[model samples]
Target: RTNDAVKTKDAFRNQAARLGFGTPNLLEATEYPLTRLTQNWQLLNSLYRSHWIIRRIIDVVPGDMLKNWIKITSQMPPDALKRFDSQVR
Candidate 1:
């Protein structure tokens, strides 16, 4: 369990580095939820089928997670976040 978490953290760091975002700030956001959404077959099925309760979770979960991720990662040093923002332009 500990090992898996460490590996996940490393992977997220690499991913963030590639996108030129600050690594530290993205740690928590990348940990379980990101991995879970991609890897959980049951959850993915519900999301795809848009099951009633799952539909509500779909409407809120990813958007909320992404918003929180951006909020935290946007706190990068000096003008780092600005530069990252410009890249999306």
Candidate 2:
């Protein structure tokens, strides 16, 4: 699944490049800026969008949508105030 995700990302970058959208640099675990990206507002917003549109709305067949939402949200830290998993300090 991880490999499949990587391939999808690669395909997205390639397709974006082909379509004249500038391909933003891909983030990877080893990259020095990976942490910055993982904590980025834009990326987190996109993740939330995907969570809504893809995870819930599109994949309506999932048995436990709320649990799936929590699981996906908990994977990332509080990148933005809207992040589902977070604590106020």
Global local distance difference test of model 1: 0.61
Residue pairs with backbone atoms closer than 3 Å in model 1 (clashes): none
Global Cα lDDT for candidate 2: 0.51
The lDDT of each candidate is 0.61, 0.51
- Give the per-residue lDDT digits (tens) of candidate 1, residues 17-74: 5543454444445755344456788878867686677777777877787674544344
| CA error at residue 15 for candidate 2, angstroms | 50
List candidate 1 stretches off by more than 4 Å: 1-43, 68-80, 86-89
TM-score of each: 0.28, 0.18
Residue-level lDDT tens digits of model 2 in 17-78 = 44423545444223553345546878766775767664465455565555445434344545
| Pairs in clash, predicted candidate 2 | none
- Candidate 1 deviates by what RMSD? 23.1
Q: Which candidate is the best by lDDT?
A: 1
